[model samples]
Target: PCPQHRERALARQARLTKPPGSLGRLEGVAVELAALQASDRPDLDAVAITVFAADHGVCAEGVSAFPQAVTGQMIANFVTGGAAISVLARHLDARLEVVNLGTVAPPPVSDGVVDETIAPGTDNLAVRPAMSPEQLDAALAAGDRAAARAAEAGARLFVGGEMGIGNTTSASAVACALLGKPARSLTGPGTGLDRYGVGRKVAVIERALRRHADPRDPLQALASVGGFEIAALAGAFIGAAARGLVVLVDGFIVTVAALAAVRLRPELRPWLVFSHQSAEPGHVRLLQTLEAEPLLCLDLRLGEGSGAALAVPLLRQACALHNEMATFEDAGVQDRS
Candidate 1:
């Protein structure tokens, strides 16, 4: 965190017309940006949003409401600019890069799709490691390379999104491994799973967690119980911090990835800004684990960086208030403090 920029922002905020701390989280958002950018004021002109699409073998275990084929279909939908995130990206005028990490049915080469297929899909974590070590390394590299490209394009903020069927199941299992919790506690109804389906998902997660009992090893936990997209999201967060880019994390699944990344590099915590609280049952626990105070609480469950993209305007408003609001002297008003 930029200590000097934080102090300067606080001092400047005191001189503004509003009462101290009136802006609530908005004020905090401004301070966080100032610290990240190492400036008294911050802006988000060049932002990059990357949506990583993949499939989870756990879908074979009847964990997800949607079939695995939807993974590749959604990637095609994204490329054609029809998905929710696609519209949001265009509305924000942000660069949207869709990566085909490893879908069950890989899309043909086309616009807006980056080919980084590591495998057709991960092995079912219920019975084996989701990915081999080599595949894990390759997924991380894909995410790292994606973030580097964003940085090279002059993106000051990187909003990492993901699309994968049965990913919530995988993320819950990873959380169970990392946090030493029961699968039942972390499992939720993903993609319209009913209570019975949720119970089945829990059982599958329990199986994966039982296989990999070492919570001390984050990478092992991820490889044992994570999906390709989740691993890439973790890698992207690390890479963004490496490039000094401010990261705005999305919903439950993305936050799960960030948690793993934070466990890997605790120093990356300050560079992260959680966008919103997802309605997914386990998201609250993940956010609490990160000690993150999200900027919005719309109960968003959409995972395609929609929550994060929606909050960008709020960040812009925070910056506008911090940078454009006049001081007491400018307005010829008496200082309250």
Candidate 2:
């Protein structure tokens, strides 16, 4: 973040008609965006939402209530303007795209989806590493390419989304490995799983954790337990930070990706603005670990970047208040003395 711009923003805020810190977190959001964009007036006029879809081998363990085919179907839904993110993107007029990282079967039609398949899916993480080092590199590169696309499109904000069955399991295992937490503490019902299913999911993650014990770094942890889309999201977050784009992180799965990216590159923390606290139980722990205060907590578990997209308007409003509000002198009002 640019300290000079931040100072300028703070001074501008103090001069606004309202009292100091009257606007609450909105004031802070504006200043942070100013610092991130290195502009006295930061705006999120151009937002890009990229949803990376893939299947997870961990689905074989019955971790998700939905079938693995749903991942590919959802990829089609995203491109065809039938998914939640698609509608949200339309509502926000944001540039939306989906990347097919890897699924069991290719979507029936992918007219607009970016193809970045690493494999059919990751290996079953419960018994072995989720992905090979080379596959992980490929996923990260795919994310970098997405960032390049967003930058090319003149996007000021980047929102990364993921669509993968059993991804919560992957994310939970990754978080457990990174945070050194137990699976039972980090795991939660995914895809509307019942209590029994949640228990099974926890046990599956525990096995994966034991199998890939003591990951030395974020990349290792990601490769050990992260899904293709999860890795891609991490890569995209890192890439967005490199390009100086403010990243709006989504729910639990996306937060896990952000966690890995932040662990891999500590400086990326400032570039990330978390969107919400998810219904998933592990999200709070991830947020706490990252020291992120999200914009909302609507019990949203949808993973199509919908949560982040929902927060865009709030950030835009912050920028608007910062850039357009009248100062005390401009309004011919007495100064606070």
Candidate 3:
């Protein structure tokens, strides 16, 4: 359906009195958005960044080098306008919102932070389910509500980021489940883990997989090892797409959540623009599965929407070119090619 609309947009672009292909990828991106919105004149009014914070039980397995407290600390950093996402959001001139999906420790009082915790922390997946079905539903509802609020605030674009220690482990497990791959194939050194730390992370994931490998229920698999913030991010993807908002996907962990959203609703794929390919091993596999080509490849592995936030300027430039570029006929330039 998008391709059909895109075809019409391309025809319109060609007849705009311009030499074909003068605008390069900007033309293509604009045409794609025109198809997505079914409008020849597409606009990106405002950008919103949602950072979902949660704590993973797998951190108890020594899978991440960072302490679980770091999740809450980073939330504070986000509120205080000191984190990478804070600076990136400022650079993009986008509004930032933080959601306390679930953190191990009590969050500090801060402006622009929404308290929507599903639980204090997930159960250790090495031994039990990370969250119950009710908790997952609540997390998804929280995301939906947040997206509604952002949409009401006139945000046309959204970026999904995460702030949870050991979340990479949860992301890896979700990727393994979705791709039907071994944990070793998807595992990477998260948060600057050493060789032994990497091994420990892989082993923990493998053990969790062995403990719960049934493929009949994807959500069940997620609940067995995924984090609340991850489920909420997945929900945000669904909510954004359902509301016809453009979604900018971040790095590996966010991609896993996007994959989960795709699994839940295949139609949501068209609204997504992947931001970057991360150094995380599972990221490539997930991107390939989604048939997504990222806009950047800076070897970035940090979460917090650092890559998506960085790519917003480029997207804005694309929009500018689409709306403002001069046609060859208007400029009196001959199309010799």
Candidate 4:
């Protein structure tokens, strides 16, 4: 039933005023959207971005050069409309909402900010689980709530991003667990870590993966090393897809979250549109596992939905070509060869 609508949409698209296969993947995207909405005409009216911010106690393990406090500060930056994501969201006409899924500091109040903290921050996964099962459940629930709110606010497209100092470590660990790969393969320079810093990060992730390696139980693996923001992003992906909203995935961290979401609900995979391939080494492995081909490969490692936000214009253009361009029949042109 879910894919049926998409199949019908593709059929209708082939019959549209254009020659078959002329628009390439753009035509595919339009057909996919039409099927997703169960309508011939699919319009991306509004976009909503949820930037989930959390803190990682694993930062104490010297995995990151930056302190944990930076997570909360960046959330403030997002709220003050000065962060990269803020600029991108404004430019893309997206409604950006910063959610405090769990930050290490006392919550700061700001306009366009939601206090959805599950706790101050996750525990240091280097020694123990990042969050308890109950805390993880609550964080996931918060994501579902956020998605519901975004849908209510007229968001037909969703972009997920995250902010946490040592989250790349957590993301690498999660990627390893989900992909059954060694930590070294998925680890990358997060937040501008140098060669030595990258080595430290890889060591930290290897230790975490060895400490908890149960591919059969992804949720447990996630709880072991994943941040609250990543868990919430997974939930957001599920909620958006279940509601038939197009979910645009960002860089390494967001891809990790999306992978976890797919593990939880395999059916949600169709609603995903990979935005770009990150410079992070682990991103390609994750993409291969998901069998996803991203629209861009700009070597972007920046998180905060910047990559996905950048790809939105291209997706819009795809829709424009599908809907606005005159077909061969409409233009009275003969198709030859």
Candidate 5:
């Protein structure tokens, strides 16, 4: 993020044929985009979206509504180009990938899906760490590989998404530990969990947080309670920012990973563009924790980078307006005294 570029973008925006700041936060987005690209003109021409699919051992706690089989099934759907993200990527003409971080069933391998299983799934976090030190490192490395592939292909913007049953429980526990809050404060329904399931999920998160004793170290907290996909998502965010690519963070589980990444590297915060606000209750607090104002708030809770993909077109519009709109002088408009 170059200060000179940001200043130039602001100056250019003020001279456009519109009231100063009339475009609201969108105008700020354009300026930030310019700063990140280190150019007065910035565009999101190349976009890549990665979906990390894994399963959580905490489903044994009866926390999620859907069965664990759904994780692998959804991965297969992604590979077959049948999932929501698949359609969105094709519609937007963005490169989409599905990374097999870990799943109980085989991931139905395909070109767009990578094979990097750390394990069949994580260990039951209720009784043990979700991933061992070695497995955690492997998952993070797998995520790095995904990000590198995207950047190497000339992707200017990156999206990190997640797919895992019972992952909300893992994300909630991680948030509670990172923020020193209770599960009751952060837990929400995941995968259409009913009220009873939500209650059980909260209880499971509380126990895990207690067992970990509210770990202050982000890695310890992540390894203590985070799911494999969650860890991978965090790694992808760090990798994207290191590669100087913008990251559009997705819904609840993915945002939790983004929070972990920011905790690991505070400088990475500027590279993130929160895609949307999730319908999940705890998302608002998480957004506040990051001080992020998302691009949309349509109550979307579907993960798998769906929200981020939808916001890509809006970013294109912002850039187009910033670059193509006529200046006040060109439009023959009078400036207010």
Candidate 6:
């Protein structure tokens, strides 16, 4: 974040033809984005959205309501512009990239998807480590490459999405480990699981937590309980921040990824703009932990960066108001005498 740009934006906001703080959070949003983009007037015209798709081995634990094959199927849906994020991306005219980290059942035609599969999928995290050190590194690298692509495409904002069956369970486990909270506290009915299924998911996460002792290490926790898409989202966020792009974090799974990335590099926190509060039980806690105030909260649990995509308009509007709105002097308005 640039202090100079922030100061300039603040000064300009004070001169706008409105009462001080009249625009509420939008005023702050514009200033913060100005700081993040190192510009007195920042815009989200070039937004890059990358949806990382993978299969989670924990699906074997019967965690999700959907089949593991849905992960791959959704990847196809993303390219075909059938998914929610796909439609949002087109609506916003943002650049959307889909990455295939790994899946047991892959799409028949992956023409638009970036292939970065570390394996068929991670090992069942309940019984074994989800990813080896090498695989984790590969996933992080894949995310970094995606970020590089976004930067090359002149993206000012980066939105990361994930598609992986059983990923909510994996994300819950990772969040539990990172936050030192109980699995039951973070676990939720992913993909519309019933109460019993939620309880079962909690039990599975508890087992994985017990197996992976010393959850203090972020990298270790991710390797033990994280999904490929989760790790990749973390990496892409860090990568995006390094290149001076504002990151709009998505739902629960993506929030966990943001947590992991912030733990790895605390400096990256300022660059992150949480998009919304997810319907997932753990998401509120995660937001509390991060001290994040999202732009919206419409009970969104579907990932694929849909929430972030939705928030883009807010950021754009904020910038528009900041840059185009008349100042007191320009509008010939009376000052508060």
Question: Which candidate tops TM-score?
Answer: 6
Model 2 worst lDDT window (10 residues): 208-217
Rank by lDDT (best first) = 6, 2, 1, 5, 4, 3
Q: lDDT per model, in order?
A: 0.90, 0.92, 0.84, 0.85, 0.88, 0.94
lDDT tens readout by residue for model 3, 193-294 = 988988898888888877775742558767888888888988998998888788999999999899888898889998998989998877888899999988
lDDT of 2 by residue, 1-337 (tens): 9999999999999999998999999999999999999999999999999999888898889888898888888999998898999999999999998999889988988899899988988999999899999999999999989998999999999999989988999999999999888889999996699999999999999888887656647898999999989999989999999999999999999999999999999999999999899999889989999999999999999888999998999999999999999999899988877
Lowest lDDT sum, 10 consecutive residues, model 4, at 104-113
Colliding residue pairs in candidate 1: none
The predicted structure with the larger TM-score, 2 or 5, is 2
Error of 2 at 198 (Å): 0.5
Per-candidate total of colliding backbone pairs: 0, 0, 0, 0, 0, 0
Q: For model 2, what is the C-alpha lDDT against the true structure? A: 0.92
- Give candidate 6's error at residue 245 in angstroms: 0.8
Give the TM-scores of the predictions, in the order they appear: 0.98, 0.98, 0.95, 0.94, 0.97, 0.99
lDDT of 1 at 32: 81
Q: Write the per-residue lDDT of candidate 1 for residues 65-159, one digit (tens) a residue.
A: 77778888889899898899999999999999998888888765456699998999899999999998888888888989999999999998999
For candidate 6, write residues 109-194 as lDDT tens digits: 69999999899999999999999999999999899999999999999999999999899999999999998999999999877999
Collision pairs in model 6: none
RMSD of 1: 1.1
Q: What TM-score does candidate 4 get on C-alpha atoms? A: 0.94
Model 5, CA-based lDDT = 0.88
What is the descending TM-score order?
A: 6, 2, 1, 5, 3, 4
